[model samples]
Target: MGPLDRIEELIAYVEAAKAVPMSRACRVDRGELIAMLEELQAELPADIRRSEVMLAERDKIISAGEKEAERIIAEGEGEHARLVSQHEITVSAEHEASRIIGEAREEAQRLRDEVDEYVDTTLANFEQFLQRAVSGVERGRDKMHALREIGTFNPPEQEESEEKPLPQF
Candidate 1:
C-alpha cells in the first residue's frame, strides 16, 4: 500500500514479536532484524533529505496561514472594541439627553407650582378687595337713605380747637 501503511504494518509485526511465546517453530533471529532496522535508518534520512526543500516550503505555508489567522482574529477584536465604544458613547449621549429632559420637566413643574401659588394669592386678594368694595357701597347707600329722610346732608364748619396730648405707655 502507501509508505505510511507499510510503516504501520512493520511496527505491528515488531510488536507482535513481543506477544508470541518462544517455541520450537517460532524462533526469530535478532541479528537479521537489527541489520534490517540499521539499513532502514541509514536510508530513511537520505530519503527525507531529498524532500527537504518541499518540507520547508510546506512549513512556510503553514506559518503564513497561522499568521493570517492571527491577523484576522486581531481585526475582529478591534472591530468588536470599536462597536462597543460606539455603543457606550451612544448610551452616554442618550443618558445626557434624558437627564436634560428630566431637569427641564422638573423646572417646568416648579414654575407651574409657583404660578399656581401666585394665582391663588392674587384671587384671594381680589376677593378681599371685592368684599371691601361691596361693604363700602352698602355704607354709601345707607348714608344716602339717611340723608333723604333728613332732607339734607350738611357738613360741620371747621373750628380752631386745642389739641390734647396723649399719655405714653
Candidate 2:
C-alpha cells in the first residue's frame, strides 16, 4: 500500500483500540504500531524522492517556458522598431518629394514668366521697326509726287561706264 493508505490503517487501528478504565488513553498493540511505523518510515524516502523528481521536472518546464516568452517579447519589440523606422522613412521621403515638387513648380512658373516677357519685348521691337519702315516709304512717295508736279518725274538713267546704285530704305 502507499504511504497514505498505511497511515489510514494506523489511524483505524488506534481508534479501534480498547480504552483504559480511568485514563484518556487506549490499549494499542505496541508490536503492531511499531511495525506500521517502520513501514511508513521505509516508504517516506521513496515518496520524497519521487516528489523531488516531479518538482525538478516542473522547474525545467517553467524555465523553458520563461525563455520562450522572453524570446517572443524580444522578437516582437524588434519588429515594432523596424516598422516604426520604415514609417519614419516613408514620412521623410514624402516630405522631401513634396518640397521638390513645390520647387519645380515655382521654377516652371518663373521660366514661363520670363519667356512671356521676352516674347512681349520682341514683339514691341518688331512693331517699332515696321512703323519706321512705313514712314520711310511714305516720305519717298511724297518726294516723288512733288517732283512729278514740277514736271521732273524722270528717273536718271545710269551710264554703263559709271553705273551708280539706287538709294536703299
Candidate 3:
C-alpha cells in the first residue's frame, strides 16, 4: 500500500480501539502503530525524490518558455527597428522630392521672368527703329513737294544700277 493508504488504515485502527475507562484515551497496539509509522517513514524518501524530480521538470519547462519568450521579444524589437528605419528613409525621400520640386519651380519662374524681360526689350528696340524710319520717310516727302513747287523737279527714270537692294532682316 502507498503511504496515504497506510496512514488511513492506521487512523482507522486507532479510532476502532477500545476506549480506556474514565479517560479520554484509547487502547492501540503499540507494535502495529510503530510498524505502520516505520513503513510511512520508509516510503517518504522515495515520494520526496519523485516530488523533487517533478519540480525540476517543471522548472526546466518554465526556463525553456522564458527563453522562447525572450527570443520572440528580440525578434519583435528587430522588426520594429527595421520598420522605423524604413519609415525614416521614406520620409527623407519625400522631403528630398519636395525640395527638388520647389527648386525646379523657382528656376522656372526665374526663366520665365528673364524671357519676359527679353521680349519687352526687343519690342521696345523694334518700335524705336520703326519710328525713326517713319520720320525719315516724312522728311523725304517734304523735300520732294518743295522741289515740285520750285519747277525744278524731274520724274527721272531710274537705272537698274541705281536701285538699292532691300535690307535683310
Instruction: Return the top candidate by lDDT.
Output: 2
lDDT (Cα, tens digit) per residue for candidate 1, span 1-169:
4223334434444445433233211222456544544554465455445455544654565555556555555554555555556765766555554555555456545555665565556556655644554454454345334435444434587797888888789
Sorting all predicted structures by TM-score, with the top scorer first, yields 3, 2, 1
In model 3, the number of clashes is 0
Candidate 2 residue pairs that clash: none
Scored by CA lDDT, what does every candidate get? 0.49, 0.58, 0.57
**lDDT tens readout by residue for model 3, 1-169:** 7655655666666668677555445565667766766786687567657555655655565555556555555555555555556765766555554555555456545555665565556556655644554454444335334434434434587866866799999
Better of 2 and 3 by TM-score: 3
Please list the residue runs of candidate 2 whose C-alpha ends up more than 4 Å from where it truly belongs after superposition: 15-29, 88-169
Using TM-score as the measure, the top candidate is: 3
- TM-scores, each model vs. reference: 0.35, 0.39, 0.41
* Candidate 2, 40-141: lDDT as tens digits: 668767755754565565556555555655555555455555555686575655555455555545554555566556555655665564455445444433
- Candidate 3 residues lying further than 4 Å off, grouped into runs, are 18-28, 88-169
